[model samples]
Target chain A: MRAGAAGLAVWPRWRPVHDNGELKSGETTMAYSEKVVDHYNNPRNVGTLDKNSAEVGTGLVGAPECGDVMRLQIRVNAETQVIEEAKFKTFGCGSAIASSSLATEWIQGRTIDDALSIKNTDIVKELSLPPVKIHCSVLAEDAIRAAIGDWRKKNGAE
Target chain B: MAKRVESAVAAACPGCAAAQEGRALFCAQCGRIQPPPGCDYFTVFGLRPHLNLDAAALEREFHGLSRRLHPDRFIRAGAQEKEWSLADTALVNDAYRTLKDPLRRTEYVLKLSGTWGGPGKEKTPADLLEEVFELNMEVDEARAAKQAGKDERAQRTGLEAARARVAEMVEGLDRELRAQWPAWDAGAEDTRRSAERAMALLVERRRYLSNLVREVDEILGE
Candidate 1:
């Protein structure tokens, strides 16, 4: 077997992400907030939409160094263009999963324009992300843009 | 362990005249800690920076080096020698890990050559870019169907096909990498230049493979 593979399975390590991206440091290693853990544990709107419905947009982003990937999807109401639903699936550290999970929660009920106003720093602040984990927030913000951009292009609103 | 920026230092065995190599823990003549040495992972095993490594040989050498580097052997030594043993042991462990994995070895070699972990600048291939756009739509459709209590069999099939396509692409690239490995291991000057070009493919292959793994997970229900 590979060197770290055995250790990883026995001890919490990268990959095999638990629900809400459980912290792997230790039993008492709760570096994240309850809110972050809560969002991660029970990410709201964790589903997909009909992208062909002319009302859906999807964004996928990953950090190469950290091996983190996030896919955020949004469905806009045709009449109001407000995000009727937002969903996400993230494969990353706890902070990244939380950031995307929180992103999906916050985007619902907001118009696409309003969603655009969401910032990485806001996510960093909201999740209380450390400086090193700040990239996770950045990925969440970028996923929003990419999803929205895809929606706009398909809807001829670009 | 992390590499340092110190200039190369060579030390000699205090008990014997045998010249100590970089990071040699013991004298060839006397079983004493050799003089302090500095070397990176490649230097630790006296390996050249390349992807086509003999894993069995590397592992064998790693075990041999690890035994000597083990700090337990230094319990009776001076404080500085014990500390050096621990540090060198840590370094050897990290080196063994990095050198053992083909993908990681490629990345490390590129990094040592100042080529890897730069700004993310690769453009998505036009074909794959279009696929990503289409795949997103399919994913949303599958999700929407699943949510609305509608039949998502079609959408699920669509995602499966997309994943298969990406998998096939990655497999092809991996085959190319395997073909290039021996050419690189030859290590002639001309082959080295060609190997550099091959390293570009290795990097791109890793990026695509990483994305494919994530995409597969997303489609196959995480």
Candidate 2:
């Protein structure tokens, strides 16, 4: 309700002011990787999937530390159990956006079980996420597992 | 100079070598400023570590200390006394700022007691995760409508409604936080720890929801 509270990061418009930019005095700045910048600028599969559909599984997760929320959905082939489409909407810093964008790209066309193998470390390595931003990659990995879990629960596959 | 003043304990006053019992910023005997005490803010005010306090009394005490410790009053004093005055004033100012506000005072108590780890140290509870995610979805929809430049009134109405709901939620959380004060202030160790955990979560949840409401207000006002 206070004036400055609105400035906290939420989604879309208020990008991380200094995620890949300036640093406050006495703090060191780390440049985002070129790949992270690219994915953030043109994020892939940024939207929602049909939550009501039997074949669609939605995963919603958040990191309270930075107040980042990510929702990822996957549409699976009923017979093949392969993820045919993946979409994501991430409200976070550049590292988070890049991680989720890359997640959608990696999970699509892979079977749900295979997608489950994707690790936060892989995203971290791919995006060159600094130590401080590693949690964003972990969040992306959690979203993948949550989506798969949701699909399994809906399918009674357990 | 101020850093050194903060780090050392002024056990004895440099001006008159009077014995100081606790970490007090001014010598009782000599009435001269001492080093900024190596103590918590509550100690600076000579109060017990507690959440509830008399705000009026605190303000009066702060003003009285500020006036006495003002550097201008120390201009003709010894150089060391002058430096001590500046350092002690800054310390009192920091202490007062942290203690005057309810939320900040709660956070400072938890931090001093080592019961609450800062953000990123603990796993966010699942319920808060769901609430925050859903709130973001609504915020995103409002933001999208505003960006698209379509159905302006509908967007404004939706945002206003959402803002009202979030404000109500924040009020609820504030009450919940306040309810834990008794356990924190007087209970046994187990009860205090549980109260600490609950209070910490409540604080974080309140912060997130209030931030969402602020964002909605900004969109509506724009």
Candidate 3:
């Protein structure tokens, strides 16, 4: 019953990844994009900002059916309009959390105008989000826009 | 009664000197300790692999085997017998746990046969796609109402209604799943494919129910 080398090909085809970001044998959730897991587990600058400060801009967004909420805040320098810091809090799935976390990281060190240009597609590309979790990326994009809008209103820029 | 799936396989009973079928726990001639590894849970308990099972008999067999496999009895046995008892006891416990619950048993049977590996990815239902957009908007409105200190009674009611609707949908999926169980038990070649379809449906149902529970929790402040 010894077979040729072609018989071994079936076993190799199923192993997509090994050890690195590999899911356990019987995980129910989709195979998470590696970057998503990175951002989710080690989210950057996760905290609250002084909402009353003229320098801080806050955006809160939630999806009804998904019941997930994301809060993103950015601190912009008054004169330069450059982002000094960014932080976010997400109460959702791993994808949602990673989306907001990556958003906060991307907003930091960029000018307000530059940050505004950031899109959900960039997040999707960076995170390798599947179709089901695309909304999480969209939520991140919306948060960035909302936060920038709030900042502009407070600073009389818009 | 359990029928051995692999007729060519045979084993010597450990407890009493007798030949037993593959994956059978007790010898037909002498009822003694014999557990075959990787045996299906139903077979472990001397029952046919079927969807509609006798609950009382399952419980009785489970208790009896658990007592037989107790570590206390292996105190004087040799190293091999002791190892066998320990391994078999753990397997017996695991088998009992899976077979006791209908949902777990269904999933276990499917997974054991290697017919369905896991839930398929990226197959969003068209109906869910349409509903998700509106539901997200409603969530946004509810949040805004709460923020503005507006009367939120209506929003809460709507959320409760959504939860009830989801529960009803889950119940429907459960009925659909149960209806297919008889086909699986019939063991026709065509029924195998039907069982695979039913298992896939169960996976989708679980996903939808999980989302509904999350939504209800957020709305109800749970």
Candidate 4:
């Protein structure tokens, strides 16, 4: 038995984003919310930050289920620990893109600790994400936590 | 053999009241197109639920079934016969396509055995996620460099190298997956369950890597 085999039941079946069309042909697909469409169309802070900079923290996360990849980065003020800037890039469905876009918008200007308080449920509520797409919000939350974790590790801050 | 909830042979032919071949698309006694069997895909091909399949033999069977079940063969017959022909042909096509591919075949069997879960449950290994994310970063950087027209040759090389690496990983994972087939095909219950979990993990990882390769191809304008 391999390590983590106990969690095997939860591992993804793995559907590529491109496969969504083929899946739709087989069965019905739910429509995206208007907010999801808007965010997907014009995502905010879609760019990269300087990873080498001491002030910046980069978090890269993926949804194993849909093969969606997201990278969230934060530039923080060392003394005050306030997030000065935030950016994100997500390669996923509309819900995922919207979740991360909303995440970046929420984290900017907040302290690192304050940003950490943001929850996946908060994202789902804000985006009106369906039950199935709730994982996308979870991915966004994980990305935020990962980014802050990275920043904390670099700054050696508690 | 996998459990059978319903059998094609159990149903008497509507035309001649003759016994049907469990997998046959047509009734042998009356030469009538049979209804699409309520059985699994493997049963549709006259095979047990097993992971290790004979690809060449499957292809031959599929061709034979497709030719006989063609709707054109029933044009002179009544509307019911024509409808049966189309439905049987569709079932055969779907069964053949699903069974011919190695990954799809394994997944089908796994599902039949109640080992494979449907979609929505997905949690990637943290280490693998880290590795995939790092590769994505490199790919993104390469694309940005190409867009800026800075060291286009270097970016092309980097992208090619990344694609090659992902492809190699997929092939390696596939080989490992195929190796597990026999254990599930004929082994005892313990071995079969172990093989199922292993194959599931391998298939999941392969899909993730394959998607990366596709993304790399898109980045390269392929």
Question: Arrange candidates by TM-score, highest first: which order?
Answer: 2, 4, 1, 3
Off by over 4 Å in 4: A1-41, A46-61, A71-87, A93-95, A106-158, B1-13, B16-24, B27-31, B113-117, B120-122
RMSD of each: 8.2, 6.4, 15.2, 8.8
Model 4, C-alpha of B147: deviation from truth (Å): 0.8
lDDT of 3 by residue, B1-222 (tens): 011223323367655667766566556777655555446778888899887778999999999988888889889978866766776776677677677877667766666665433333333343543344345445445654554557778767776776677677767777777777888888688877778666655645454464555556665782
Compared with the true structure, what per-residue lDDT tens digits does model 1 show for residues B93-210?
7678677877667666665654445345443343543444344445545545554556667666766776677677767766776677777667786876677566654565456455
- Standalone chain B TM-score for every prediction: 0.73, 0.90, 0.73, 0.85
Model 1 off-target regions past 4 Å? A1-32, A50-56, A65-68, A75-85, A91-94, A108-117, A130-133, A151-158, B1-38, B70-73, B114-174, B186-222
- lDDT value for model 3: 0.67
With a 3 Å backbone cut-off (N, CA, C), the pairs that clash in candidate 2 are none
**Candidate 4, B1-222: lDDT as tens digits:** 122224334477888989765556677787777777677887777777777898877888888888887667787988877877777777777778678878778766766665543444446666777677667667767766676688878889999998998899999998999899889889999999999888777766775687778777876873
- Cα displacement (Å) at residue A26, model 2: 14
Q: Name the lDDT value of residue B158 in candidate 1.
A: 66
Question: For candidate 3, what is the recovered fraction of reference interface contacts?
Answer: 0.00
Ranking by lDDT: 2, 4, 3, 1
Q: Tell me the spans in candidate 3 whose CA falls farther than 4 Å from its real position.
A: A1-92, A95-158, B1-22, B26-36, B115-152, B218-221
The superposed Cα distance between candidate 4 and the true structure at residue B49, in angstroms, equals 2.7
Looking at model 1, residue A115 earns an lDDT score of 95
Maximum-TM-score candidate: 2
**How high is the lDDT of residue B119 in model 3?**
31
